[model samples]
Target: MNLKLKEKIRESLSAVLPITGIVLMISIFLIPMELGTIVMFLTGAIMLIVGMGFFQLGAEMSMTPIGEGVGVQISKLKKLITVLLTGLIMGIIITISEPDLQILANQVPSVPNMVLIITVALGVGLFLALALVRIRYKISLSVLLIICYAALILTSFFVPKEFLAVAFDSGGVTTGPMTVPFIMAVGVGLASVRSDKNSADDSFGLVALSSIGPILAVLILGCFYKPTQAAYVLEDVETVVTTQDVARIFARGLPLYAREVLIALLPIIVVFFIFQMLTGRYHKWQIRRIMIGFIYTYIGLVLFLCGANVGFAPVGAYLGKQLAELSFNWILLPLGALIGYYIVKAEPAIQVLNHQVETVTNGAISVKMMDHCMSIGVAASVALAMLRVLTGVSIHWFVIPGYFIALVLSRFVPDIFIGIAFDSGGVASGPMTSTFLLPLSIGVCEALGGNLMTDAFGVVALVALTPLIAIQLMGLVYKLKTGKGTPTERAVIADDCDMIVDLEEDE
Candidate 1:
């Protein structure tokens, strides 16, 4: 209704149309897509567009401000123990609600669903505390990452071969739609309370750190559990006979998601309500507007999930199976690369992150630049994912080297770039990667007689890993040209209010 909301919608549409058009053209050419399937794709696309619009609006209205408020309050508390506890609790709560984690948990055959969820949550909670401590003490993110990864590599050897890929993939999926906006905003909020120049840079590593929790936890799970069975059960689908049937189906599905999104959002809502009661930070008018925005978010998430899970997943699985069954299975590499490029553009959280990165860097890091970096990274990751299925390469071979390069590059990039790079890694792998890409990979792996847990499971992890190097490489280039030092000493520079403005005006 308002100008800002309209602009957000415009941005969402900009992202959706290109992918929709490309997919449509390709479907018409490559496959004998039926009318019903076409309708399903359109329904999913519309849901994605509207979902992005609503989710972004809700994040702006509710998550960002609330996270920033919480960050300020937590900083004022000034006690290291309290700050660490707050971070840990929030991490657990947020990761538990993560939709991406659920997507992953359902696919894993070895661990009990609740056990996997709790393990992942605990992992996130522990690392989130470490992230908070890093912010509090102004630790070098690169050094911490190196040390943490050293532990990851050492742990990998003891873990079973089949579970390793899934374990790494969990790192990427754990920071999904529900987690990204809140955690990133929390970083921004916390960074805002400090005068550190690197505060903006520091804000990004939260998503990066939170991703680490699941990898470690899942790896630990693998040590004790052997994944003997591949969980690739085909979901039941009732073919809709007509347009009205599709409408009825969506309507029936809507309420289920409405309930789920509301439940997912309840913790943050309650936290905000309590914060408002105590601090009275917002006026009545502001609360009314935010509540309305939250309603849109709830509706948006419901449609988005219903459409994606019901409409998109089966299609992805079918396509991957069809393609892999062909003599030309290797063709999945370039085709997947093209899809990965376009699909990353469609990820809801990526738009928010792209805008944030452009802002934080004062247009020094443009959205187009970020998009280009992510596109290339995703393109490469998807290709690798396809390759993994065809060749059955170990995930550690790719991930260890990929992370090693990313960690080493972190030392050379500007502090802001370091933060943004890690954040980009998480944002690049959002809901779409888990829902579509993971299924696609699994289908292909199943068709190819590859180990599902090992071959298909690390697609999300690869998606998350590549961006760290890509974005940091972008930063390295920027620094080489501009000669800016890593913002280590100026991590807490006072009075750089332009950070907020920079994010807001991103083109």
Candidate 2:
């Protein structure tokens, strides 16, 4: 276990170092931030590396086992209502536990936090159950995505303009690092019960369908709830003066996030205990391991969130404001693009999703491919978001067409890629995007005196949007390279007896 954690930390270091380097370079040459602030950022980066290491290991042990156990048991049930209800209840509980959703809820000032959280939770529960039904019935993922997105698009017209960005953003934010692994493990468990050729493909779409719930839920809420756009304010971050000041900041911050992570993780623990009570699924030793995994998860998240919120966020905001105020402010466009290019790699959930994809697809979609594709997709999205900040362009201008293209491409790509693409969209926009990139955009928008709701927001939505198209396009290239229904396709997603096959896009 120690060796495994060391490996995870090493991998995390590789993932995080590039973005950390970029920030250091920018601080030294471009922004020239206060030494104390730079020290805080460095501290946060260290926390991130260690936290991510522990989080990944913990998730694999805890979330994976519990979710898979639940999924397998649920799939074995003879009655449909029991399965659906189980899915619904599980969805609601897990989503309510999501720190990301809680973060997003606080961002919307007009709507009550509990109200928005419940609404979004209900949406996830319903859609997650729907996703299960789709898998059970062997329904085409493309058709369902098209229908749901169309409803979401039509619903947007009745929504107030200010709420649009927030609504779209809710979709991305709800599927952050905390939720993706468990939700996906359930899908894997559910699919493992089946012997059909399509189970692997079906397993990939749960996150995709689960992502749509927040958008639809928030958009519907927008129709009735009128928000006061100008009332939205960016919270001011406190300045650090000395080494003790940075230590004091983290010392104070850790407990707050520790409480938050505890609250977020409690429901899951209760559910697991209930599951054990009813199912007697695990051996005593297995139960002990899971409980330990939970502890690791708890500690990891507290550190990760504290570093991100207390350390990275203020620096991101300050940098954006400073850069946008520059005489050569046009540099914001390129600089944003460049930072975004590397930042997506640092998202902890991206590692989970990449590993999951490779495992489920039997290496058909390599981690290297997923990494490059995600990076490029996110780069483009952030560039476009920076443009929106500079010019105050409508989100629908990018989103509507982007989704349209993604949906259109879905028809042409392999069935597996459609699910992978949409899932990537959600995974790409993880906690990092929320805590750092969102604030950066807000800072730029604040500096330019743009509508914060309209211009500054939706960075997350864009982050979630482009990967849908970018990944499916990679699938298109894969299709051309490996033709339809070829050995690569079949072998990549085969049973245990099949050998692992590699399909490269040549980077």
Candidate 3:
């Protein structure tokens, strides 16, 4: 195995083991899962470990380089129109490449998948263009976020109740593995042209801004499309019994997800070739490496989708239903919180975002610290999501207050931290949230006979929302500790070689 791949797989195991342990404990102590279900969950855990490892490496090798190349090219455009057009086009392509978006779209039965996907893509494209412009000219990330979110909030009232949660969730799913590396890299590439103290700060918000676009787009879509009850294809956990059965199960799943992933990657591959042809930015060796990276990303995604959707989702739903039906169902809150705390560590994009933040911030924002903050955030979000699932409360109660706090803190944190805090909100809810958390919530909701759309669907959005506040709170602590300076100046260590990847050398 490649050394980097081995390291990534090792890191993934570190993230996965705790969650697997938690699930096993739940099955053993809290609830007795069927043997087949236990086997399925374990298989899924194995796949998640390997898939996440591959995905993270792929992002490093393929997505990051491509984003950097494109960002630089976009920044080099003389005409604003050219830049905007490029950003718009690239945003749509990359958003289409996102696996989480497809997962979310599939769950939504009211709107056609392609229609929802395209709308979200358009939204991401528009805001991505705006984000590029913001970086080019150095606009206030806080101000832009406020305006975009204010518009989003105002628009929500006009959207139907049934469709509201899904709308917000559209925002969350867009910031997954596929979009982040490209979006963040574009930010880095655009920022690279400038030699300013704030360039890094500006580089942080593209993901933040891009996250908003999908929500706004989907909300507008909700106005025209009346959402009905969601139709979920809950997996049957008892279908596979033995190791051969599991292999057959995974084998059956692999091709469909493989085809989907390949289709998702096709546009990006085209973009890569186009970038090479138009700019001659890559050497032949670079091209070869990139193609290899694409292959890694494809394989990783197929395995991940199979593990998450085929292997994990059914078990999550079953566990949720079992737990919900228990005598002291209140355990769902803390249990959900515990799972939330660890499951986030397993999100491939969370690692990607953390590495980027740690690197760009010169280790001031260490990955360990990020993990802690995000775990806490996710814990709170999951607890709240479970609360909603149990009591049938309004999502508006959480969504409105959460964003308000997150935005308010944006005023206080360092500019780069503001960008990071917002983007982390999105990155925190990647494939794992889509596959496991949402299904878990839905299972609880179904067991309780609650409204699925209103009660359960917003788990992704909640997962997206809480991290903003949590991270910004951490940012406030950092500012108080460091006492007023640019994040670059406040760095605890200077460009820690181990944390930061050398993009130029890699390319």
Give a tens-digit lDDT track for model 3, residues 303-400. Answer: 88888888788888988898999999999999999999999999988999999989888898899889988998999999999999898888889999
The runs of at least 3 residues in candidate 3 whose Cα sits more than 4 Å from the true structure, single-residue gaps closed, are 485-507
What are the TM-scores, per candidate, against the unseen true structure?
0.92, 0.94, 0.94
Residue 15 local lDDT, model 2: 85
Instruction: Please report the candidate that would top lDDT against the real structure.
Output: 2
Model 2: how far residue 423 lies from native, Å: 1.0
Estimate, for each residue in 334-430, the C-alpha lDDT of model 1 and write its tens digit: 9889888888987888988888777766888888888877987898999999998889889888988998888987776788888888888888888
- Candidate 2 lDDT over residue span 1-507, tens digit each: 589889988988988889889889988888897777788999999999889888988898899999889889988888779778987898899899988887888888589989999999999999988988888788999999999999999999899999999889889989977789888899899889899888888888888999999889999999988888644345555678888888898999999889888999999999999999999999999999999889988888888888888888888888889889999988888888888888898898899889999999999888988998898789999999999999988998999999998998888788999999999998888899988899899899989999998889899999999989878877776775566656655444343212112334233
**Model 1: residues >4 Å from true position, as ranges?**
236-238, 484-507
User: Which structure is stronger by lDDT: 2 or 3?
Assistant: 2
* Model 2, C-alpha of 78: deviation from truth (Å): 2.4
Query: How many pairs in model 3 have backbone atoms within 3 A of each other, for residues 3 or more apart or on separate chains, i.e. clashes?
Result: 0
At residue 489, what lDDT does model 1 achieve? Answer: 20
lDDT of each: 0.80, 0.87, 0.86
